[model samples]
Target: MFSKIRKAYQLFKSIDFEQLDKLSRKVDLPKVMDSFSKLDEKQLNGLMKMLEGGKPKRELPPINGDFYELHLRLSEEDRALQLKVRDFMEREIRPLVNHYWLRDEFPFEIIPKLAQLNICGLTYEGYGCAGRSSLMEGIIAMEIARVDASVATFFGVQSGLAMGSIYLCGSDAQKQEWLPAMQQMKLIGAFGLTEPEVGSGAAGGLTVTARKTEKGWVLNGQKKWIGNATFADVTVIWAKDVDDGEVKGFLVRKGTPGFEVEKIKGKMALRIVQNGLITLTDCTVDESDRLQHAHSFKDTAKVLQLTRAGVAWMAVGCARGAYENALDYTRKRKQFGKPIASFQLIQNHLVEMLSNLTAMQTLVYRLSELQDADMLRDEHASLAKVFCTLRTRDIVSQAREVMGGNGILLEYDVARFLADAEAIYSYEGTKEINSLIVGRSITGFSAFV
Candidate 1:
């Protein structure tokens, strides 16, 4: 029995004895191990081939953040701009983003370099815009958020939401006057829509009131979560018209009488974004400042339509950032005498995260495609927004989980993503709000009250 045990040890060295014992019920281990031990070089090779037979080989393509080959689809000029922005983000933003996030402060120095990207108002035709495809614009948004979500939010407000208001709703003269300077980032813009008491319900519940007087329009109300409002040269404010009861938009230039902005502090997510609580006490603006094309809440919905798709792209970027960082960390982190990634349970978590991330990437790609074709509807963007943000929350959580105790540490990087994902989930639209948008479209019922 001692000799047999010694020989069995040699044969089953690579295979666990416990596993071999389990296999003994199916195959006589004594005979099998003896045969395995006696096999010469040629016979051993043949036996190995037979054991692996009939299993199809799966050669997976290399993992990449840009799953749909979007960079290759861009024109040379646009591709160059994309790379320039990516380079700027990697060099200027990546190094200091975590620092700012830790301190909950904005990095003012990087603004100049970011302004140099010439990507603001990317999809708008004329008015100093590159007039690129919406797909390219979406790609740039993804790239920006992939590095730093706060910066992306800053740019999105200045470029898409704020500038887009003027581009889509302002008069022809307003576009000519503001587009060039804003595009160059010489004139920064902020959007004021959500109020201190209203958020997702801004469509019908804006507390800000705009009363027309001999001087102009008097705006009296408060806005909350207005990004970049603290330092913006111009803030696009949406308020209810006193006479017509329709929601109207105004281009309230900075320093307007009765207009004030105060920074909102102690935010757990998107800390780098200087969100503001704006107050308007009889803030008067010239008649020309009123958005000529913005007749009602439906018009404001259009602006949201354009920006919501970009938010979905941002969600994809966030998940990708967390995934890449976690994957790299797992490969390098060792535990129990081997890489934690080599453990079965850890691998399962990783695969789950990757699966969700891949699904999000594909969904956003399709969403952007639909948007570029001008076939995108609210429900289309809403679906992607709901799906991606939900998945991003899950993916980032798993990312932190795999990091263990270091997951909660800001220096580890994944922790920032985990925290910031909460903002992404709430902003643009909450999970329930976005789902209701999609549900209304598919079921032909308006569930939002």
Candidate 2:
């Protein structure tokens, strides 16, 4: 007993007195030492264990899909902006997602906070836009969808489809009028392209008709699945020119005499996105409101081409959200007195999910690189869309599978991602449609016809 005390005393002496004094100023070191000095060998062990009980529990590293550390490749400025968007999504979007999705309601309350992020027109050059790289834009898209696909879809329509239309096809005067306010999100925007009878072939064939008049152009058509149309301040309505038999775009403002919008309801997926059925019965748009640079369907295709890569990134986000949630659940959920994550089968599912997720991340990283380099093509974006959305469906399925019955519950979050994946798979462009686009590129034959 004396020997043990001597050894403990020697160890105490080894700690410098000055260091101890400094520590004493911050903590009750003398009291702690006195308490330890009173303990016998077994008592010391017991006291040590008790002290440890007050210490923070060991925490596991967060589950992330970026196994290759793709985020590190971004420049410091870009990386900081990426984290800002991610923080916004986590803080603003995540909490409200399940609630809004369940009620089929849009959270108008989030708009001002969202605008504060200054990410609305992320990649545009002029106006109040960030004028960031395509890579940064893709990263932002992934971050948004990581929390909620519905929110991501709404954002994509506003920033990518709507704003991109103006940036790519609107004249200098038109851009000056809309881009600044839209960039600040003071003026919300929507893109109207797909009509009731015209969807996949919207590029060449649109049922929406546009007639020239001295006053302006008269637009008559029905647009279906037009996201954000119900409340958008400006909706870019695309119509076929009656005289030239070519597609043209018109900036149709809200409350236009013949413009009508009905909120599309009873949706099973992405319910938070306010899709609308817009009817234009002789909706007269001023000639000045027309997208002057938009001469043909080809001009409209440019806008879709720019935004399609973003859809692919959004798929990666959906899969990542589902995978991470499932992984967390498996680690905590016990079976046979052990965590399910310990089971070989559950680990297999995790590995598969991670593999698909990594593939998607790398693919989109390259896709955005191509975009930034101005070497991106329609087929490049389409391939990524086809691959990522397909893999996301599988990843979300595995996420659900690992969770057993709880996976289907909205509280689990995996169910929403799974349901949203179906919408992503079909929207923008279906698998078969995008596949044919790629097929034509490789074979040098127009298989789409």
Model 1 steric clash pairs: none
Q: Specify the poorest-scoring 10-residue window by lDDT in model 1.
A: 1-10
- The best candidate by lDDT is 2
- Candidate 2: global Cα-lDDT? 0.91
User: How well does each candidate superpose onto the true structure, as a TM-score?
Assistant: 0.84, 0.89
Candidate 2 residue lDDT tens string, 219-307: 99799999999899999999999999998999999899999999999999999999999999989999999999899999998999999
Minimal lDDT window, size 10, model 2: 3-12
Model 2 TM-score is: 0.89
lDDT of 2 at 241: 95
Model 1 ranges with Cα > 4 A deviation: 1-63, 67-80
